[model samples]
Every structure is written in structure tokens, then in C-alpha cells.
Target: MIERRLKALANGPELRAHLLDPHTEAHLEAYAGNIEYGLGTVKMPVGVAGPLRVRGLFAGGDYPLPLATTEAALVASYHRGALAINDAGGCTSVLIDEAVSRAPGFAFPSVRDSGEFVAWVLGQLETMKAVTGQTTRHGELKGMKVTIEGNHVYLILQFHTGDASGQNMVTLAAEAICQFILENSPVTPDYHFVEANLSGDKKASAQSFTSVRGRKVTTEVVLSRQIVEQRLQTTPERMTDYWRFSAMGGVLSGTMGVHGHYANGLAALYIATGQDAACVAESAVGTTRLELTPDGGLYATLTLPNLMLGTVGGGTGLPSQQACLNMMGLAGTGKVRALAEVAGGLILAGELSIIAALSAGHFARAHRKLGRERGQEDTDTSTGQGDQP
Candidate 1:
């Protein structure tokens, strides 16, 4: 199979040998339904950053975080920022909101029918919630959003999912809710579907940005001027100025986030801990702020509105992924909120370091140094072809 793939790519013997190397002892069955023409597991470089501290509603104390990424200087930059945060007595993290939602739309023959359906749905809210409750013990119907068009109506069901990312959970709950609506609602629709495209599940849309999709979490830190100058090698004032400029740039560009490198930390963490890494689509959108304090300190905050994470289910049960989750004490129930806080803390560290490097004029220099090092690591001929017994 690998030989065929290599031939398809028009590659050489050496490349074929390299491709088969990582598969030698891997359990291909583990990925039974996950891949096609599977040869092996692709490896990612996971770096541990910080014995960083967090004071939060759920997460507290000091711990080392595992960040898996291929980007050069990502781990180092976040580490530097974490150290600075540690020096300033650590940071505080909090989970502010939680919900997982799906919108199912119904199109009727006329606007009056849509209105009747909407009115009926509103009246059956409690019954709808009860029907959804039968789907899962961990998921509870939280709320519903209603949208009306010319002859279409959308009912967005929201659920509070415990210890899971909730895409599947909410889908199940929505199914049960839909069944109830179908059986109970008086205004029958001309047509209906499970997803109305109003939920904004995975894509960039105004509804997701305006409301909660998964969990809305906020993490903040206060960097003392001494820590900033000593650890980040930049003045608090300069960092603040740069942050202001960056915020303006985001505004001018009309971007969803007003932050620096939230993806860097979140992506690495998500991959390491077996999260649905694609959820970073909505999870990565939020606000970051740099507030200047009178004592020359910097108050930094990163708020993630749709951080989809879980300590169980999905890829979390995979051995290596579970190990990574366990490393952060995130391998059991009641850890989802704490994990969100940790994610927020890491984002703060990453942003602080990148902002510092930008202010100190070392961004390019560090990349040049670390990136060349990465290139050399990739070239180390330590790989060998696999043999099936």
C-alpha cells in the first residue's frame, strides 16, 4: 500500500521507506474507522511549557503544560511568557458561560405558519427540555433560540454538556427535541431539516460570535513592571502600546478576534489532549485586552467564547492522548471547566511572549534561530522502514 502511495506521488524509494517507518509497531486497528489507506500515525513534536500557576474558579496551583506543535519558537515563546506570569504571582482563570447548540429549521407554506410554529415551540419549551433530557444523563437542555424568515422557522436548541465537547451530545438532544416538536407542534411544516444553518456550528458566522457556542471562559493575569522588564525584556508601556496598535489592526481588518496567537497555544494543547482539534474554528474566537495599571503593571486578559474541550469521549481515550490529558490532571470527570481555564492561561502566556518579542524587535530573530534548529531536527536520518510480522 505504501509503495502504491509513493508511486502515486511519483516519489522515490527513500521517501517510501520513510513513510512506512512510523507504522512498524503501531496498532492500525486503533484507527479502524478513522483513516483510509492508513500507513502509520504521524508524529508531532510535543513541548512542555511552564510550571505556570493559575488562580481560577476551577483550575489552581502550578503545573507543566504539554503543547504539541510544529511551529518553531511556539513552545519557547509561551514558556517565556509563563515564567513572567509565574513571577507576578500567576494568573486567574474563570469559566463564565456554557452551552452547546444546534438549530433545526422548518419551512412552511406561508409566513403565518412559521409564526404559528414559533409560538407553539415557545409554549412547549419545558416539554421540549424534558424530551431532550431523555437522550443523555450528562446533557441538559439549557435554552432555545428562535429565528423566523418569510416561510421558515428555526429552533436552536442549547444544551449544557458535562465533560464532553457536546457536538455529538447536542446532536442527540436536538434529535429528541425535534421528535417532540414534530409530534406535538400544531403547525406542520412543508419541509424540515435537523440543521437549519442557524446554529453556526463550525463556521464563522455572526450568530456564533454574538452568542455562546460551547463554553465562554475568561483568563487574566497581571504582569508586574519588574517581571515585564526582566522576563519579557520590554517595558509595560511599550507592550501596552503595541497591544493597542494590534487591537486597532484587528478592527481595521474586521477579524473575529482581537488577540495575538490564540491558535498557537490552543492548537498545541488541543492536539496533545485528544480534543476535536477542528473545534478551534469557533473556540479560537474571543477578545484579548491589555490594560495599563497605575503601578506600571500590565493586566492581560484572553476570553474564549466557544472553547470546545472535554476530559472524556472523542479521542481522549486514546492511550497517548489520555496520558497527555493526565499530565495536566485532566483525565476524569469535573475537569472540563478546569481544562478550559488552563487553555485560557496558556493563551495569555503565548500572547504575552509574542507581544514582548514584537516590542523588543526579536520576533524575526528568534524564528530564524529556532526555525533553523527545527529544520535540522527534521533532517536527522533516524527513521527506518517497517516490517509486518
Candidate 2:
């Protein structure tokens, strides 16, 4: 039936042969709730970086990072960073906060109506908790923030979702809360939507830096002057100088967060670990700071305010994603917080290596040597000289 519909759309036999072969079609039933009109899977190249060492509240010891990407030089750069960090006795990572939110918008007939609705909603916190409890076994209504914009009121409902990314969990809970408000509230909304776009779902926003969307994590490492020079092929002072310049560039460019390439490492890890890869939009927003320590070492930190991920739900149950999670010993229950810490560490490693490469004038050279296709000359003049390290 699926093939017939594709054929009607003028898809050629050869295309179907590659996309819907017997091996691929056999797994269609398993993807029931995850997809509709399932075509086939695209095989992405996966690589492992680390034995990156980390010490955190939930995560401890060294763990291999499973990254799925086709981008060249990415895994190698992160691997180099991980090695440097390990030599420095690893990084300290911490999961600072965790929460998932859904902002439901209510349109009122007048500003007075919206004002009354906000007051009523504030008084119904306990009632809203009860409504959310009926929706999910693992989700809990933590708190909510009411934003009034003229006659429209946005209720940002927050939830504590255990061991899951909680996007769907919070959405369901928010819907129940909205339903309760519609039934019991004194002021009737002209109309209401479950999501008001104020929640910063799967997008980069200023709110990501100020509030926790899913998980907020901070990871830091201190590298001695000798270690920075030997392992990163750059001096601490040079790296710090380049970091200051980069920070200024970020500010000038109006970047939400100041970091080199958080998305590169995050997107790969998310894909490999069965996370909502789209969440990288906000998950990658963070600050990376590099400074010279009093003892002549380099003090570096990466603080990510939005790290939406899970260990037991969504894509985590899928075959390949589960394998990746298991490789890090982060599969199943009691591992989501640890996973967030590891994610922070992973981003820190990438940031360190990239900054070192740029500071040492090896950025373009490394790319030309490892990032380009075989037999391809370095023709991209945009990045300046591709000097050898």
C-alpha cells in the first residue's frame, strides 16, 4: 500500500528499490508512532571520540563520546581536546538545572479580561498541578510564569520530567492545564493555543541564556601552561587572546551565546544518542570563556543553558541510538542527568580544541589536510593562509 502511493507520485522503480527494499521495509512496523508514510533510513557515519574524563554530581570517570556525522575533522578535533582535558585530570561538569516548559496563549476580549485571567491562573497553581498529574505518570507541574501582552496572556507552564526530554510530556500537561482553565476560569478566552511560541521550543532565543529549557549544565577544565603548549600546540596566553577576540566577534555578530561551534559536537552526539536533534537550536546556546589562571594555566568553561535530551524515551529506545547510549553506560533509568553532564563536557572539549587550532594558526591548515576530499586542493581563500601547524 505504501509503495503504491509512492508509485502514484511518479517515484521511479529504482528510487523505490533503494528506499523501500525488503530489509528497510521490515522495520516499518517498529516505527509506527515515530513516523507516517515511512520511506527508509539514511545511513549516517558514526564515530567515537574520547575516553573524555569528567567529574560531576551525576557523572564521573572517563567515557567514550559517540558522534554521528559526515563532517571531516570534527571528531578528530574533539578527540584531541578530550586527550588534552584528560591530561589535565579531566573537566568538572555539573547539571545545574532541569525543566521543560510549554507556553499556552490565551486571547481575551480586553486587557481587563486578560488581567483577571492572570489573577485566576495564579490562584490555581495547586489545581493546575492536579490537572497535570492526571496526564502523565512521570511529569510534575513545578511552576508557571504568566506573561501579559495587552489582551493576550501567555502562561508558561513548567514541568519536571524524569528521565525523558519531556517536550511531549510538557505539552500534554500544558494541554490539561489549559483545558481546566477553560472549564473553571471566570473569564472566557476568545481563543487559546497550547503553544504560544514564548517557550523557545527548538529555537535559539535570549530566554535560553536566562532560563532552563530542559537541562542547564556547566563544565570547566584547567590546563597548565605546559599542557596547553604541548597538547594544543598553543600557549595559554595565545589561546586566551584569541578567545577574547572571538568573544568580541560574537558580541558584534549578535550571537545569542558566545561559543565557537557548539552545534557541531552537539548535533552529532544528539543524533547518535536518540535525542531530539532539532533541540540543538537552543541546546547549543551557551557561553565559552577562556582566561589565564594566576598560576599561568588556562581556565576554560562552557555553560549550556538548554540541553534537551533523555536516556530512556523517544529515540533512545531505537536500536542504533540505544547502542550509542549503552556504549557510554547511559541507557535506561537513572542516567539522564549524567547524560546532560557528559553533553556539557563534550561541548567543552570541542570548544577547547577549536580555540587552540585558531590560536595556533592551524584552523585552515587542519581543515585543508583533513576536511577536504582526497586529491582536492585548498582552493577556499576565505579563511586566509592554510599554514602547517
What digit string (tens of lDDT, one per residue) describes model 2 on residues 144-258? 9999999999998889999999999999899888899999999999999999999999999998877899999999999999888877888999998999999999999999989
User: Cα deviation of 4 in candidate 2 (Å)?
Assistant: 2.9
Top candidate on lDDT is: 2
Error of 1 at 144 (Å): 0.7
User: For all the candidates, what are their Cα RMSDs to the real structure?
Assistant: 6.3, 3.8
**Worst window of 10 by summed lDDT in candidate 1:** 380-389
lDDT of 1 by residue, 84-169 (tens): 88888888989888898899888899999888888778888888778887889998998887888899888888889999887888
Off by over 4 Å in 1: 1-29, 33-38, 373-389
Deviation in Å, model 2, residue 89 alpha carbon: 1.1
Q: After superposition, how far is residue 90 of candidate 2 from its true place, in Å?
A: 1.1
Give the runs in model 2 whose Cα sits over 4 Å from its true position.
5-13, 20-23, 373-389
Worst 10 residues of 2 by lDDT: 380-389
Error of 2 at 25 (Å): 3.9
lDDT by candidate, in order shown:
0.80, 0.88
